[model samples]
Target: MESMNIPMRDILQRILKRRKIRPRPGLNYNLEKQEEPGVSIDLDATLASMDTMEFSLVRENSTRRHHNEGSEDEVSTMADSLTSHQYKSYIVSMVHRLRANTDVQLGVSGEKVEVDPVGSKGTKFFKQRAMTYDADNIASCEVLEEKSTGKSVFRITYLISHDYKHSDFEADSEVCNEIVSKINNILELRLSPARKDYVATRAAKHLRKRDSLRDSFRLSKYTDN
Candidate 1:
């Protein structure tokens, strides 16, 4: 019913739950709760529960695709603005040439994203698809980084999901593993020191220029009792 970007989604859910906002007469939000995400992932449920908190930290060490449409979750043109992942996907699709390391990342909604050539990629907005109003579901994703001896050797991640009504973290672990595998194959085949600077630098720019990982509380409607 309510939505908006905020600090860590999980933390927000806990706050809402304790404050007696959840299962009550209201829009929606999240709190500071924890659970085992297991090995599986559900991109759809993850995205649908944008205002809720995380079920597990181990499973949630990933990225999301969202942005404020004037600080409100409901919008006439939800797709006009791009979430971070949506932006990432759009840019990749725009200038992507498969000859490069760019691989299309698909999630539960059957939506796709890609990475740009290891270069200075800007965090800009493009367009988005109309978000379906399914209070019971969401699509979520993560960017995976594999390290070797203190250096990232491989990196890849994507969103996963299941039916909106099903929020079970372990429900789609198998599908999540498969998504990870697809990304890893692409990264292992394309990642290299020569292009490392380009790829790493861009992501670093995003890290430095983007919002904090724990700032979801102040932003989402779920926490805005």
Candidate 2:
């Protein structure tokens, strides 16, 4: 009997990422900066937001206790494990979601081991494992040494440059904006914070009732006051 051959889906394939482009999204991003002369941009990049990281705060007690020879792990292992095993998983998951089917590019670079897709130098050091999600991305990353074994902190930076045309500039800006907006949306769902209603219709509705000549009414007391 001939067996049927149904292809099994690949796990890594499911998590693959792609780069998206607008071709002429909006503004050109590579023009030289107006504020600094001869200091030009390579591409239109935006600093998404800075996320401060506490790589690892070592505990003296742990360090002293582990000082014996042939210790199971060092005080810094806590951070290293956290960053490499746990945090790296989160970052990978995020990149997958954002890049899957969305046309997003990613790359990794350091010591010429890997290359960045964007090909820019603005960076952040994280107690992270080196990763190259895409081939042509810019932004070299490094996993620097931290001081704790329980918590590995990482720094992730978004890079930008000025050599981009207005169209690419706007597209990159829009992408950054979209990411920020998504975060804001998630925050709103949780705290439900109050915001000033700039386009409120309640006041306008009240004014409409006041100005309306369509609902004129007469009141009668008939001296029964």
Candidate 3:
């Protein structure tokens, strides 16, 4: 029986060989043909183009950053300049108001005189005069007069230029108070003892109003900006 099975297997093998059946190829022919030299060159070119695009993007981003930084710095500088100008204008305006309220006299001749509010060196001349009262230079003294007799009683000099060095708002308040104190002292000394209490009560009101007006102006400016 085993000998009969071996002859049948030999017959089957010969029949299959005559029919010419073959095994499949290991590599895919279509894929191999598609990946030719031209395709590889195109892939390399695509990679190079991507690198160039990436470099361009990086450079553009860096340029934009630098431009933004420069613009920010310019804006900051402009804002600082505007603030400084506004502060100076406020100081000059205050000096003008002081001159308007009080009688101004030249220190040299002890004669009553009028000073120009617009062209006068506002704080600079005041500071100089406070440091050293010059005979030749224009050093003016402010005179506070009694309303009843129209008589010059209290003489308070302006030393506002000394406050230019103090940048803080509190320092400005202190300087204003110091000036007020000088005025009040002169009033107390010149007036009768009976009116001393009344004079002291009204001492801070005028200066306080001036400071309030200044603060309001600053607040409005900040809001507008």
- Of the candidates shown, which would achieve the greatest TM-score relative to the real structure? 1
| TM-score of every candidate relative to the true structure | 0.18, 0.15, 0.17
Q: Write the per-residue lDDT of candidate 1 for residues 16-135, one digit (tens) a residue.
A: 443345444444332212222233333324335444333322213343323345423422212221131222222122122222222222332122322223344333443222222121
lDDT agreement with native, every candidate: 0.31, 0.24, 0.29
- Which candidate, 1 or 2, has the higher lDDT? 1
User: After TM-score superposition, what is the CA distance of residue 222 in candidate 1 from its true location, in Å?
Assistant: 46
Task: Point out the worst 10-residue segment of candidate 2 by lDDT.
Answer: 1-10
> Please, what are the lDDT tens digits per residue for candidate 2 over residues 15-51?
1211121224442122222223243333223212112
Ranking by lDDT: 1, 3, 2
Cα error, candidate 1, residue 80 (Å): 37
Q: How high a TM-score does candidate 1 get?
A: 0.18
Q: What's the lDDT of the predicted structure labeled candidate 2?
A: 0.24
Please estimate how well model 1 matches the true structure, expressed as its whole-model Cα lDDT. Answer: 0.31
Candidate 1 error regions (>4 Å): 1-171, 192-195, 198-225
